[model samples]
Target chain A: MILVFCELKDGQIRKPSAEALSEGRRLADASGKKVGALFAGASCAGAAEAAKFGADVILTAEGATLASYSSDAFAQLLADAVKAKGATVLLAAATAVGKDVLPRAAARLGAGYASDVTGLSMADGKLQAVRPVYAGKAFATTTFASAVQTATTRPNVFPAAEKAGAGAVETLAAPAGDFKSVVKEILAKAGGKVDLSEANVIVSGGRGMKDGANFKILEELADALGGVVGASRAAVDAGWGLPHSMQVGQTGKVVSPTLYIACGISGAIQHIAGMSGSKFIVAINKDPEAPIFKLANYGIVGDLFEVVPELTKAAKAMGIGSN
Target chain B: MKILVALKQVPDTETKIKVAADGKSLDPADVKWITSPYDEYALEEAIRLKEGKGAEVVALSVGGDTAKDVLKNALALGADSAVLLKGDGQGDAFAVAQMIAAYAKDKGFDLILCGNKGLGGDNAAMGPMLAELLGIAQANVIVKLELGEGTFKAEREIEGGSEIVEGALPAVITAQKGLNEPRYASLKGIMAAKKKTIEELDAAAVTAGAQVSALALPPERPAGRLLQGDASQQAQALLQALKDEAKVF
Candidate 1:
């Protein structure tokens, strides 16, 4: 059997988790094994949602302590599920929560895990995965031959596959790990609609954006395209953007979205390390010498100040803007 | 108080990276090494704590011969001493953590610090994995840190949020972008770094887990076509393409 660690939050199903479940089902089908879904939380409300997404068996780690994510506790729970289900493979989303918790789980199981997998295939009952290393500068073909293999898929890389009905839910006994750390409080930024990773189209600005006040242009373009606004490391470092969620590069989030629009970005190598994988890239920069033009599928050698407003107006008039 | 900061030598952030002949790694030959940026924040924060409370700050790095350079930067930045685990062969975070934790076991340090992640491999694995191995409380991407009587208070960045965590002394913390603005090397500090003795140790394997097979530059993005003419013409062209060709609004 193959297991997918279906991540949940606030007693609700997360889109990334749904994508994981969908990918897990694909892997299970290829391996001819049952797809077991694992959820660690205080309640099983979200576990039931995984079933509708093609989960065959939903394993719940329902306990008071499982309410929040503790790496050690969640790893033990997932490891136990892997053991109990006799799963030969496990999958998790490469989100922030998954990144923190999965490595510990792999360590507990003493199983090798391939992370940020952009490609996976099975041959002769062994799993082959394509993962990028050296900060997105290189790709590696790694094989996991252990009885069980684990991998985490990048968000939005695999579209969520949803079906009609919920899968079968099986309540599990309490997981057996004591967690010492706790989340005292969480303070989040004010509301925004687009998720940085999940957005199909991304409109990003860099240091050339000049100032925080200039971000309004990018935001307007993003709103018109119904996309999220991302910032480069330079802009984020300069305090023009948030650090946590912004997709910077190489060391930051690797996104392979459909359309990536870079405005006033000079395309530093470190910055290019992250989002170079987008299917279609558009660069809007006044400086014709900017390196971003080299990678742009469409290069606009005009002032972003003028280009962005025009782009926004054009998108809105075309009915692509915000509802 | 005593603090230990872990560091690594990575390619200068501006280097136009070239893929290694093998395709699974970068060509290390022409790349000039610099201290990983995030580690600088860690070192600075440790120094601030040491200066404010009269603490001892030691810098540690696990890498090949070149990694010693990172410690020199740390010392120049204000670390009391330096340690280097020399090895070019790559080991996963677990092994690297084990080497550091083993060294840290007898050091009697009150706190451990490192960058949230390094740019070299970009896995962001070592600090948290080390904390786990040492059975110490940890928080990553810390924006603010305060040393109290017996506990350490920190603000760590999460996905789209931030979390406030409190832990006892001897905890491991990873410095994030906004932790502190790292200081530039002073002339006197640079001279001192040249004289600083970096205790070199051999790195060992922790686990035979993930291995890199090849490296490749990302595929090139296609050239973009501009919608020329006036605003209305541009809008019409864009709309026509969306309705007929691109199919994306």
Candidate 2:
């Protein structure tokens, strides 16, 4: 059997978790094994949502202490889940939380782990994965050397699917111990915008945005396209967006949206390291010699101030994101 | 207070990655190696704590003699001492963390620090894994950290926002960007570093946790097409291309 770690947000399974579970279902089908969705929290309220993704069993590590994520506690829960289910493979989304917990869990279980892998396949009844090294400049085909094969799937790279399953809920005892770490508080960003890592479409600006207030135009265009607004390192450093949260570059979040529109971003090699995985790239800048055009699928060498508004108007006229 | 800072050396960010003659790894020749960017933040934070509270800061890394350069740089940055865990410095996150944790498990250090992730693998796993192995608490990818009496308050990055975490002493703190600006070594510090000895210790032999079978670059993107005409025409054509040609929307 394969066990998947499910991450929760507002008591609902996040998209990346669903994607990982979907991949788990695919792996289970190929190997003719059961898929177990492991949820570690005070409640398994949303475990049933995994049904559409074809989870055969829903294992909840429920207890008072499991209300929030604790490195040691959650990792023990994951390792115990794998042991209890007799699962030979473990999978999770390579989110901030997933990357934290799975690796610690692997250490405890003495398992081989591949983090943020874009490819997974069964080879000789074992899991093999392909992950980007050097920040996506190179790819490495990774194989596990331990008995329990564990890997974290990269977001927006794998296609999510739906298949009916039991999604049967089963409770396990959460590990009890002195959890030395605790989350004192969470400060949510204003407006509750979609996170850059999970967004399907992204409209990113750079130093060319001119001023922080000018980001409003990018916001307008992003909303019209049903996407999110992002900024390059220069803009973020210039306080153009929400500190560094909206930054897209080597030093920031690495994203692979389906449609990426770069406005005024000069395309530093560091910035390209973060978004090179995007399926399609559109560059809009005044400088015809900007390096961004080299990697863009389409380049519009025009002033972004004049060009972006026109694109927004066009999107609205075409009813692109009316739904 | 005693703090241990762990670091790794990786290719400079501007270096165009090239695959080696071997199909499964990076070619070292012509690669200008630098300390992983995040590790600089880690070392800088440790040095700040030492300067502020008169603590002892030691820099540690896993590699052969060439890796000593990282330790020398750390000393020049204000670390009191340095240690090189002798090994090939190969393998995944587990391989690196195993050597460091084994060496530091009983060192009685009050705190541990490292980059949230290295530029080389960019896995962002070693900090939490080291904490787990040493049975300590961890705060990862933290941009703001405040050391308290036997406790700490940290602001760590999440998906769309930040979370404040509190943890006990003897914890692992991974440094993210915005933590602090790493300082350049002064001429005096460089002279001082030249005289300081880097203690080298043998790392226990361990098998790699993961095996690499192949290495390859992503398929090249087609040559970018420059749109023709003025702003308005380009916008119209872009919409048409997105709808009909690229079909992204």
Candidate 3:
């Protein structure tokens, strides 16, 4: 059997979980095995959603101990589940939580593991995966040599399929393990800022924004467009952004937003490595010679202080992002 | 307190990577090597902890002699000592983690640090895998950290926000960017580093669990069609393109 770990956020199944399920289904079909899903948390409210993406069985573990993410606990639970199901292949989305838990679980099981895989296939009853290395500059095809194969797929890479399955949910007791670290508190970002990795639209600033206060203009524009505000490493290094979480560059979050607007940002190769995957790019800068113009779908050579407000007014008048 | 920081050397991010004739590796002819950027953050954090709490910082790396450069750089940046796990072949994450864990097992360290992920592999497997092998707790991708007596509080970035986590001593942490600003090596520090000797050890023999069959570059994106007009006209055109062509808005 092949197993996929379905991740949940606030009791709802995430998109990446569905994608992993779809990939799991493909792999299972190729290997002539059944595809199963494991959902462990305080609640397994979205087991049905996993079925929609082609999970034959949904294994759930719910208890107070499983309410929050603890690496040791989750790894133990996953290792137990893999053993109980006799799963030969395991998959999960390569999110922060998944990346933290999967490697530990693989280590416990003594299984071959790969991370951030973009392509997966089964050949001769063995798993093959392709993952980006060197920050997406190159791809490497890897084949597992252990008895059990495990990998975590990168988010937004695979298309989720809505092929319904039985999705029979089975509740299992949470595995007991030693827990040394625990989450004390989760501090949610104010203003409901979308995560840079998952945002559909992103407006980013750089050192040309001058200072921290000037970022307010970019934030306003982002809010008006129903997008999130991002910063180049230069802006973050210059202390123009409060948290480094908003940074978008090679050393920061790699984003592939649908629309990425570069405001007053000079495009460094590191920065380009992160956002070059955006479907559409817009560059607004005072320097026409800025490297950002080379990658932008639209370029405006003007003072961003003036150009940005004008663009914001135009977007507002057109009801561009009232949603 | 004694801290161990795991470091790796990688090709400079800006270098034009050319796939070697072997079809599974980069051509090493003209590649410029530097310490992984994120590892610098780990090294810097260790130096800060050493300065603040009278800790001894030891930097470690796994590779051939080229990796010695990274340890030397770490020494120049204020690490008290450095060690190189002498290995010339590529090992999967599991093998690499096992080697490091074996070396760290007998060493009494209060904390272990590494980059969240190395730029060369982008695997993000070493730290957590090492933690598992050592049977210790870990805080991955931590941006802010506060260490106390045998305890630590770390803040890690998640999807929509950050979470504050607490772990006890002998914990492993993978440093994220922005954890600290890495300091430059001064003349005095460089001179001192030149005099310091880097300890070399043989890596435990382990078979690679994963085999790489091929290496290829991603398909290049088509050149963007630049819009022509004033700022307002360009904005209007972009909006139209979003609605009509991209269908994103």
Candidate 4:
């Protein structure tokens, strides 16, 4: 069986986890294997969605220990689930939680892991994973040498597919863990804003944004485009009160948006690596020589203060990104 | 208190990459290696702890001879000693963790530190894997950490916000970007670091769980175009291009 760690947020299946489960479904089809979607918590409520993604078996690992999010406990739960099912492969979306817990589970299972993988396929009964390396300049094709293989797919790189499945639900016994670490509290952000990792289009700012107040214009543009606002490392580190979640760079989030509109961003290699995978790039800068112009398919060498409002008006008129 | 900081050297973040003739790895000839920036934060945190509370900070790295440069830098940055686990640098994160776990198993270190991830591979797996292999608890990508007698309160970065986690001593904490600003090696420290004897040790034979079959550059983007005329004209052309040529939104 190919097991997917179907991550959930607020009892709903995260969009990226759906993509991972669908990837598992594809691999299972290729290999004539069963696809199992495993959700860990005090109790799970999203098995139906998992089934839509082709989970032949919905496995739930539940207990009070898992009521709250804890990487230590979750890793133990995943390792136990993989063992109980006698699964040979494990898959997940490379979100913050997936990246945190999957490796620890791999350690327990002695599984070889490829992280932040952008591509996956079954080749001669083995899993071949492709991941971006060297700040997205190169891609490496890696394969697991261990019996149990694990990989986490990058968000937005894989599309989710839905198909009917048996949808048999099974409750997994939670592992008793004297957990080493526990999350005491989570300081949550305000709701309704799109997450940068999943946004199809991004309007990003940099030091050229001048100050945090300047970001309001970018936010207005982003809202019109049905996208999110992102920031370069320089802007994020400038102590402008920009949340690090919106940071796009080597040290921050690596995003693959469909349209990346870089405003006031001078295209540092660090920032470039994160957003280089965007399908189309647009640069708005007063200086024509900014490195960002080289990557942008459309460039406007003019002041952003004037150009941005006009662009927002145009995008709104076009109904861009609005479903 | 004794803290061991594990460092991995990667190609400098700015270097343009070329695949080697082997088709499975980077071309070493053109690559200039530097200590992964995140690991520098790990080393910096350890040094700060040493300065605040008397402690022994040992720097550990796994790689071939070129990796020694990273260890020397760590020494100059105030690590009391350094150890190089000599290997061919062909191992994956799991193999490296196995070696480090073996070395640290019996040591009476109160804590261990490493970067959340290496830059080149961008696999943020080693620290957690190492902690699991050593049978200890771990906190990863931590931006803030407070150590107590036998416990720690660490704030780690998640997607939307921060989560504060608490763990006991003898735990592994991986450093994130905001952990601390790493200090540069002073001239006096650099000279002293040069004279300091680095403990070289043969690494245990470990098996790599993954192997790279081929390496290739991502498809190059088509050459970009500069919009002509004034800002209004440029915006108009850009929207047209998006609708006709790019077709993105």
TM-scores, all candidates, are 0.91, 0.97, 0.94, 0.96
Give per-residue CA lDDT, model 3, range B196-249, as digits (tens).
Answer: 999999998765567678888877765666666776777777777777887877
lDDT of 4 at B165: 89
Name model 2 segments beyond 4 Å from true: A238-242
Put down candidate 2 lDDT per residue, A26-70, tens digits, no spaces: 988898899999888777788888888899998887777887677
Best-to-worst lDDT order = 2, 4, 3, 1
| DockQ scores of the candidates | 0.48, 0.78, 0.65, 0.72
Write the residue-wise lDDT of candidate 4 on A244-275 in tens digits. 77889877888888899999999988889888
Candidates in order have lDDT scores of 0.75, 0.88, 0.85, 0.88
Among all candidates shown, the one with the greatest lDDT: 2
Pick the winner on TM-score between candidates 1 and 4.
4
Compute the lDDT of residue A284 as modeled in candidate 3: 85
Predict model 1's lDDT versus the native: 0.75
Candidate 4 clashes between residue pairs 3 or more apart in a chain or in different chains: none
Native A-B contacts reproduced, model 2: 0.83
Higher-DockQ candidate of 3 and 4: 4
Q: Candidate 2 local accuracy as lDDT? A: 0.88
Candidate rank order under DockQ: 2, 4, 3, 1
Worst 10 residues of 1 chain B by lDDT: B87-96
- For residues B12-86, could you state the per-residue lDDT of candidate 1 as single tens digits? 766766877776667877788887788888999999988888989999898877787788878888898998877
Best candidate per DockQ, number?
2
